[model samples]
Target: MNAADAWKLACGNLSNSESWWEKVIQAYQEPCRHYHNVAFLDRKFKLLDELGTASDMNAVILAIIFQYYEYDPQDRASTNNLAHFQEFASTNDLPQGLRSKVEALLTGNEDDLEKNANGENDVQLLQDLDMSFLGLVSDAFLDIIKLERKEYDFMSDEAYNAMRRKALQTFLLIPNIFLTNVCRDRFEAQARANIEAEVQSLGK
Candidate 1:
């Protein structure tokens, strides 16, 4: 479905925050966003359905909400959105347990996959689902990163290639790219291949 539908399903009784949700959705829809858009959120939702903790309703709900928490293009650094999410959660009367988990995930460093992959709970599953999209849509995702560089006017081929290589290298260095067994089986090989190919191409 669309962002509106996703918001309804994920946000539940937080219907009063329609304006906040709209602002978030619009941020993802920003013209500069090529990949981290509503479509990305939809993909994460699909993955959550497929591999998330469906048994725990709270887990599933939290996973869906976390996917969009920092997906907004405006929050490129993801700093502001964390506070926004906590406030939104508090106002919506989310339980302390779930709210704490959300805070942990948001406060954790985005680049520290190992640090974030602390537990096998729904939060970890949510993190996996978020990263899984990058593997699944490797080429397109990389293209989006490149597009973002262009938007900022990278200035030269060297600068752009350096940025691209750094991103690829970081992914390659990750110990376990996919957290779930099913996702790892489905994507590891192809993702590695794509990343390796991109890294190789950077020199050409």
Candidate 2:
């Protein structure tokens, strides 16, 4: 499988984020870009303790976070998209409600995964959720932000801005997931503030 496929499926559980995806690639000539992207995220989980709410995550909420990761960040252009998107969905057999959303997203054959799709229904998922998990999630976010394709060498300002804008749109979705009370109170606000600041600083 390719680096993207390996990243989505291998990150079945939170711990899987730390797995060696480079070894699984067919073209294992250099650093598997996708693997390092994820590993960079895995390393970010260390901050959970600072929030004083590190050990709170139940398996599913944690699973939600993990499952959320597996879903492709790319949009669906056709039917086989489900087959492709499934590679990114959580391996744990998603919750019925969440599964319904996945099916809907797939069946509708939409372009990109939107904010409300996963953001709306957040209950005890956060009560059980912890700082470490958020740390990991944020790390994942950072890794994604740092993702630089070998293709995008130093180039024109317009070219760089276009890529940055697309990435910023994706990054904007994370705060929606953290809308739950604990996440909002502890991390979401700070994350948003930081994102905004960074977004403002991008070409300066």
Candidate 3:
């Protein structure tokens, strides 16, 4: 489904305003964004159907829509995306419970991964979906790598390679890169292989 249809489905019975949709589109289309664009959202929306279930499908969709709303290669610590999403939720008069769930998913922290591994399913599904790109077949995975590298074009090769290697290594060190059983079964081995290959390429 397209993002607009997915947004409507997610907003079910809530106020789905054109202005809000326009803002989301604008954010993703920002010039600095390469990987985190409408195409990315469409990919996630497609994958959402394959993921088993979420406690709140609405919140998951919302989280996917807004997760990178405020991305900046220069500001890795920026929380503006979450802040903006909260503001959007409040403005749309969405239920507090739903907003909270979406916030937790968007946070995408290690704690959420732990909860997923411990049997809490919602966050696990969301996180697995986020990392699904890593598990793509070799050619497709390399294509995403090129797009991601464009996002950090400002960085010198040495700096970008060092940072990228560290991030990829962290995934390798994780006992299970994909938290959910389904993802582990489907993508874990290939994801690890892809990351290892990318890390080697970065080193050279």
Q: Pick the candidate with the highest lDDT.
A: 3
**lDDT tens digits by residue: candidate 2, 36-120:** 3444334333232233342222322233233223222243132253443354345444455555455443344233323333342
Question: Could you tell me the TM-score of candidate 1?
Answer: 0.73
Indicate the TM-score of model 3: 0.90
Predicted candidate 2, C-alpha RMSD:
9.6
Off by over 4 Å in 1: 1-3, 54-78, 109-119, 137-155
User: 1-204, model 1: which lDDT tens digit per residue?
Assistant: 444565676565664567767667776776655666777677776666665344344435554554445543434565466676777777777777666655656555323223323344444566666667456567675675565564445257797788778987998998878776667777778788788877898884
* Candidate 2 Cα misplacement greater than 4 A, ranges: 1-36, 40-81, 84-144, 148-157, 163-177
Root-mean-square deviation per candidate = 4.7, 9.6, 2.7
Q: Give the poorly placed runs of model 3, Cα more than 4 Å off.
A: 108-118
- Stretch of 10 with least lDDT, candidate 1: 109-118
lDDT order of candidates, top first: 3, 1, 2
Angstrom error of the Cα, residue 202, model 1: value is 0.9
Give the per-residue lDDT digits (tens) of candidate 3, residues 14-91: 675678888889989999888989999988888777664566778788988888877888877964778888888888
Quote the positional error of residue 204 for candidate 3 in Å: 5.9
